[model samples]
Target chain A: MKIAIDAMGGDHAPEEIVKGVEMARDRYPELEFMLFGTESEVKPLIQSMDRLELIPTTEVIAMGDEPVKAMKEKQDSSLVQAANAVKEGKADALFSAGNTGALLSSAIFIVGRIRGVERPALATAFPAFGGPHREFVFMDLGANAENKPSHLYQYGILGTFYAESVMGISNPRVRLLNNGGEEDKGDDVHKAAHQLMKNTDAFNFLGNVEAREIMEGTADVVVADGFSGNATLKAIEGTALTMMGQIKEAIKGSGIRGILGALMLKPALKAMKHKMDFQENGGAVVLGVKAPVVKTHGSAKANAVANSMGQIQTMVEGKLVDKTAEFIKENADKLKVKKAAK
Target chain B: MKIAIDAMGGDHAPEEIVKGVEMARDRYPELEFMLFGTESEVKPLIQSMDRLELIPTTEVIAMGDEPVKAMKEKQDSSLVQAANAVKEGKADALFSAGNTGALLSSAIFIVGRIRGVERPALATAFPAFGGPHREFVFMDLGANAENKPSHLYQYGILGTFYAESVMGISNPRVRLLNNGGEEDKGDDVHKAAHQLMKNTDAFNFLGNVEAREIMEGTADVVVADGFSGNATLKAIEGTALTMMGQIKEAIKGSGIRGILGALMLKPALKAMKHKMDFQENGGAVVLGVKAPVVKTHGSAKANAVANSMGQIQTMVEGKLVDKTAEFIKENADKLKVKKAAK
Candidate 1:
């Protein structure tokens, strides 16, 4: 199977994307890559290879450009072109480290979404505690804001499918993220979703889980509206960064004694930092689409880019799309009630 | 000044609380502490100190009991008796490392609110990079759920007062805690609060601050509704703990190479861990009240209890209650707008 890579995306684009493609090609010699960008920009980065194919495109989308507007006006842009490659079946999947909104909009508008899906969601895997720990999937991380209760229920269904497909966890435990772990502690939307999840047999409803429980290995699939999920994710990221910076200053501030103590604790500290790193999870996948689309971090390095490519391969080879299709078809009536209510 | 201590509160109550009182008496020679609990529980622990007063009580609030129910029925409970001391003018203030919800209710319903106060908020100092570095004061940590726009504005005002009064910062900058740094990223409540803050002459309204900015020393006061603030705070704590655990495992997972790298990075890691520890922030202060009420952590040790007592002294000596009263009186018209809207 071939996957299209947005060569003009990311800070270290063209080079890192090319390196990632080469790494993937080395591992799976039968795998083909369709690199999209201007020949002049792509030539210096692409080493001579038979399987690596460069699809020439003159336009490129700047990182700061507005997504919806750029997608509408810049038809010839590399992001749009790469997406078109997936649409035309030239590649089975599309990967970009460009503007997240633009990549999502391009995938939905250009390649299109599944028939019954109302809105596509951006899904990410969170590492749980313990060995061979199963990852929990959450939808609409930042894709759709101001979600209705039905949207949240749909997210639960989609997230369950994604978890079962990728993590290979059968009958995954599904939970609604709330302020308090109690069922009655959330706002109106959360209360509505709580009832829906309880009534539906589409998922393994585990009841309300607090933000703290997310990291404590409470559920296999956590669901929420984009605003809360995105806010929670950003808050976690911010706190991790803030704590790291504080730890650095504090150890140094202790002068000699503090520095000595810090010296003794160094090994455990590095291990801690790596666990908090976002790169370890690869990147977020845009779910509910006709084909796989992975949106890596905009500032992703070579290793991050390589991991994202591997994620694409995992999704494609794991038949995640087919599993999602099957799940949707089997649970069509519940989804119908959900859609009607919306 | 005399302060009532709930000797029956917290995980290590009676024992730790007694030790903390002894430490406080030794530290502040002129200060007096009234230990509220059954005489049987307090007699064996501390019966010699001249400054240590014992106020006997019989009931106890279990850890799992609902706050309102506990407050209403456990009339002679240690937590209630402590609050009664504050209400009857026997003690200058009350301190408890107990059920936070129960403490909050007793303070509001029993001790009563300050005149003209619409709602009382819980404010906690989050240690920044280093050297105090302008600790962030967040309000309504868990007092009220489903907060309105006006409630957020009031939080900004009260939070600013706490920062300036307790932390000794002049004209503390106040920011709304939002999902993103952008002005337009929050929910309807945030948008409304944003407009109110800009127009009202009550604070030095800095715009919307993302979750990461809380630890980056961007604002002295980060205000939000209780639900979001509580969730965000807990999520941060959970992530830090998880990261610390993972880091330790990673260092031990591999062989000598990992051990050598871990050894080399010991000091740096220790420094990082120390910074994320929130216990250094003392306890969360209940702002916009008639008296200085400090809520210690449920798991607070002797040092944390001491920190809470120290905070009370700082506020009382500075006469922050009078200063905050003046500030509120001066901005009475603006505050009335909030009261009317709510």
Candidate 2:
């Protein structure tokens, strides 16, 4: 299997992306990689032999550029070209750490979405505590503007499948993210989503799950609208950072107790930090596309890029395409019925 | 000053509430207290006191009980009676650790709204690290179901005055919460709110702020419609709690490194815990109302209740009512213009 990598994207750009490609190629000798970027920039970074190929491109999409406009105008850009390669079946998957919106639009416009998928979503698997712990998949991190009840139901389905196929979780417990833990907690959209999840036999639908419960590993698949999901993801990130900062400040405070405690708990704090770190997971997947499309953070480093590539390889080896196709085929009549009901 | 306490409205009910009232009465010699609950339940807890009085009734509102239904049918309920005390001018403010929805609706329906205030919002000042060490006031915590652009603008106005008066922050920075930092980041409502805020002269508008920026002390007032605001607040709370739990687990993990680190960082982690703890703030003020009302967490202890009562005293002494009135008078014409433009 061959995966296309956008070497001109992200903070580390050619350096990190190139390193990731070399690492993945080295680890998996049979796997092939198609690197897209300027030849000059890609040459020095390519240190390995065999399996790896270069698809040189002249244009680079800036992180600030309008996604739709950039996708449409930059015909020769690395992002669009990489996406086009997947659309044309030159590569099985496309990986990028560029502007998320640009990547999303390119995937939707160029690579095209899988049949029966209405809206694509960004799904992240956050690490959690307690038993049965590999964390849960939450969508859409930053995709659609407003999500209908059906969208949330679809997110639940996609998230569960992704968890099962990608993360190796069986019978993932899907949940609706609501303000309160009760059935009547959320507003109209949430209420509708809750009802749809309960009524549908598509997956294991856990009743309404609160934010606190999600943190405690209550659900394997958490579903919400794009606005709430994005806001929730960011809030969690900010809160974690804030806690880390506060922990640092408290350790630095000029006092005997502070110094004593800091000395005693240094290792414990490091353990805590490692557990909450998002870098270990590398990047999120823009699920529901026809082919695998991993959207790494724009500021991702070499390790994150490598992990993203590995994720794509793992998905490919696990036969995600076939599983998704089968799932869609099996749920076709029900999906159409759901559409009509909506 | 007189304050009404919902003696039977929390997990601890009359026991904690009575203890809080006793503490408040002892701390403030001249302050009058009226405790509301069923005579049979409250009499046992109501010990002899000079300044504290018990207004025993026959009704009680359960935690899971419907807010509007309880308010309408159980007129003599402790929560309703407490609100009635404020409405009858027998109390300066009302405090409840009960159903948030019940308090908000009862306050609006029975106590009445301030003139020119279209919808009274439930505002809470969230603790943050910044200059002068002030907390940002977020509005419509759980009041409105769906928020329009206009409601956001009003929430901004209310939050600004709340910070300025209660928190004593001059010229507080007001920000609208959005999915992205860009102008075109959100749906139509966010764009409209941005335009309105840019045009309004009454606020120190700071444009758009994403959820991740909140912990970095982005603004003194972050405004959003109730739905998003409530979801964001809960998400943050969930994230903080989750991180704290993870930190605890990490420190307790196997090996001497984890144990040593947990020991060293014990004091520091405690400090960090205190910083993120909502219990530290005591209670959240119900802003945009005619009079000051505070809602403590339903599971609050005596200390939280006492602190909330103290907050009421400080707000009253600070002339928060006059400040809110002055703000309404000043921004009346500008709000009219914005509405007209819409």
Candidate 3:
């Protein structure tokens, strides 16, 4: 199995990307990588030549560049070339730690969407609180600004398949993210989506789950329209950040005794932080694409990049994308958007 | 100023309600309260009825009961009677620590909507991370499931007036709660709302703010469609609860030294918790109503109940509801929904 890497992407760029690629190459016996970046920048960073093929590219997509515009203008950029490698079937999957918009663009427009899939969703795994499954997948993390009931239903199936095949959860329970946790509690779109999901025999349909109940691991997969999903996700992240920051301030403001107390409790706090760390789940998968495309964090180190590569390898080896494509293709009628009637 | 109090509501009803009413009556020299509840159950709890009047009500609206149905059927309920007092001009404002949905029903159908107001929004003040203003008001916290650009525009005006009149924030910044921070970042509804707010010479429109920036106090007033508002609010609350729970577990699971350290940090942690508590900001206001109607937490104690009454007193003394009604009525044309034309 082969994966195309956008070597010029991320904060660490060539050095960390090359090191991570080498780590994954040594780890996976049958895996190979085609690194796309400036030759001089990426060449010396590589520790081993074994199973690593460097494909030089002239242009680079900066973090601030407009996604669609950059993709069109920067034809020789590493992100573009890496996406092309997957499109041409030279590689089984694509991986990047670049700009999220650019990576998503590469996944959708370049690598292409699977036949019958309306829109690609960003699927990220998150830590769940005290359940059999310590983690759950949240889909459509701001991929599409607006979505029809059909797209939401499709996300239900896509997320379910991802959990079963990639995360190894059998018959994953799928829940629609709603404002209130009830059968008929939501806006027109969510209420319609709930009905659509309930009627289908595609996956294990759990009823609506509220944002508050998400961390409790009530559902293995939480599906939402991109706008609400993005807003809610940020709320959780922002709240957590604010609370932690305040705690730090409190500890500092409490003077010597409090500082000494915090010092002794470092291990416990570290453990909590480790559990909350989303990076341990690897990068987010731009699902519904023809091939597996994962986007790691921009500030990812060698270990994080290697872990993302491992996730990509699992997706490719399990043929998760192929399974999703075939399923969607077969159920195109059910997944078709019909909101105009509403 | 006279405020109608719903005595037979919340977890600690009658007892806490009466105590709080007495506290507020004592604190505010000219304040009088009409306590609505079953007289037999309420009168014994009142230590001194100097300015507090106990009005007998036969029925009660349980939290589990349907809001609209309860409002329609339970006419003699405390929540209904208190709201009726406000509507009949027997009381200057209304206060309830009851079922949010039921209180909202009373506020709308009984107290009535402010003229030209499209919808009544739930405005709750949350503790900001750190700023000149430690608290910021978030509006439309699940009052209307869906909202047009016009409703969103009105939320800006309503929320701004609220901050100025009640919270005492001079030239309060009003921001549209969106998924993205950019001016052109949201979906159709939000994009149009941004345009509407930007074009109008009504309030201080500070463009769009993502859910994450909310706690940072980027704006004094953050307005959103009810669905997004509810979801985001719950996410923030849920994440905080989860993190605190995890920290408690960590402290408990830690060895003797860690536990000792945590014990020493109690004062500091308490300060942090105090800062994070939303109850200090009083109850949520059902804005765009004829009178200042507020709903405190269901689990509110005497202190919290008194605090909310203080908020209501401020709103009443400032003629906030009347000011809001006049402003919205004057700007009816600008706030009219024309999305069908779009």
Candidate 4:
């Protein structure tokens, strides 16, 4: 399997990107990487070229450029070129730690969407409490700020497929993220989406899941409109960070005894930190597209980038994108019939 | 001043409610309490009748009862009666730990909305990072699930007054909560609200606040449509609870060394826990109402209830509601002119 990497992106950029490729190539001998970037900038960063191929590109898309405009204008940029490689069937998947919007735009416009899909969603795994599974898939994490009930329903279907095929969950329990767990909860959009999800047998519908229940591992797939999803995601991230910071301050302010306690509690704290680290989840995936496209955080270093590569390899090997396309194709006629009835 | 208390509400009910009233009465010698509940259930719990008066009522609103219906049908209930006391000017303020929706309904219907206020909002203080002022107020927590741009603007006004008078922040930095801090970010509704806030001189309108910046002590009041506000609030609460649970598990699984470290770190943990506790912030206030009506957590104990009473006392003494009404009266013509222009 081959993966296309956007080398001139993220905080560390080509250096960490190349190191990550080398690490993945060493671990998975059958996998190959195509690095896209300016030759002079990326050449010195590559330690070994055993299973790696450099696809030189002249332009670079800056982090702050508008997504759609940048994707259209920077045709020769690394992000665009990397996405194009997947579009031309040169690679099975595409990976980037670039501007999220730009990567998503390239995925949708360049690589294209599944035939029956109206909009593509970005899915990230949120760490869950005590269960056989460590996390659950939460989708539409800011791909579209506004979504119709139909779009939300489609997210449920896409999220279910991604959870089952990529995350290896069987008959993945899918749920609509609502204000309350009751059937009559949420606004008109969520209410309509809930009913639609309930009538479908495509996945195990678990009804409404509230924000408080999200981290409790109540469902394998939690679907929401991008606005609420993005807000909830950021809230969790912010709270966790603030609490951790406060805890550190508290410990430090506790005098000499606190220092000794910290030393003894280092192992436990380390374990907790690892559990809270989102990088361990291997980043978010832009689902409903024709090919697998993964995006790591812009600040992601070698370990996170390598983990993202491994995640992409798994998606490719499991044929998750192909499965999604087949599922959408099978449902096309049913969806059309439903729409006609409506 | 007299404060009306719903003595038969919350998980602990009459016992904790009466206990909290006694605590408050002792702390504030000049203040009186009007306990609304069945005399049989509440009289036995009161420590002294010095400044306490039990107002007997037979009906009780359960936690699961629908809000508006319960408010209308259960007029004799403790929650309703407590709110009615404020409405009739028999009490300066009202406090309850009952069903939040029912309390809000009663506050709006019985106590009434301030003139020119479109909707009443639930505002709660979220713990902020290291500052002399420990928390910031987040409004429209779940009062109105859907809000117009006008309602959001009104929240900014209400939140500002509450922050200044009750929270003791001078010219508090108020912000509109959006997905991003960019000027043109968020959906159409938020964008319009941003423009409205930007044009207003009623409050200290900071451009925009993202969820990640909420806990960083960046703003004194963060305004959001109820949907996003509630989601963000619950996400923060859920993350804190989940992280605390995980940390406990981590310590337990680490053996004797971890156990000793935990013992040594007890004080630090206690301090951190206190900082994260929502009860420390004195519960949520029902803003835009004629009277100051505060809703404590449904499972609140004596400490939380007493803290809520203290909060209500502060509001009444500071005349926050009256100040809000005055602000609305002063701006009534300006708003009318703006609406006419629209």
Best candidate, DockQ-wise?
3
Off by over 4 Å in 4: A337-342, B130-132, B337-342
Docking quality tier of model 1: acceptable
Each model's lDDT comes to: 0.79, 0.82, 0.88, 0.87
Better model by TM-score: candidate 2 vs candidate 4? 4
- lDDT value, candidate 4, whole model: 0.87
lDDT of 1 at B12: 87
Candidate 2 displacement at residue B342 in angstroms:
5.2
Separately for all candidates shown, the number of backbone clashes (residues 3 or more apart, or on different chains) is 13, 9, 0, 0
Model 3 agreement with the true structure over A93-178: per-residue lDDT tens digits: 99999888889988999999888777899989988996789789998889888988878888988899899888899999999999
Clash pairs of candidate 3?
Answer: none
Tell me the spans in candidate 2 whose CA falls farther than 4 Å from its real position. Answer: A254-264, B254-264
lDDT of 3 by residue, B236-302 (tens): 8889889989989999999897799899888888898887788765999999989999999899999
* Each candidate's DockQ: 0.37, 0.62, 0.83, 0.82
lDDT of 2 by residue, A53-172 (tens): 888999999999999999999999999999999999999998999988999998888888778888888888887666486688888887887888878888888898888888899999
lDDT tens digits, residue span B59-123, model 4 = 99998988899999998999899898999899988898988889999889899999999889999
Winning candidate number (lDDT): 3
All candidates in order of lDDT, best leading: 3, 4, 2, 1
Rank the models by TM-score, top first: 4, 2, 3, 1
Q: How well is candidate 1 docked (DockQ)?
A: 0.37
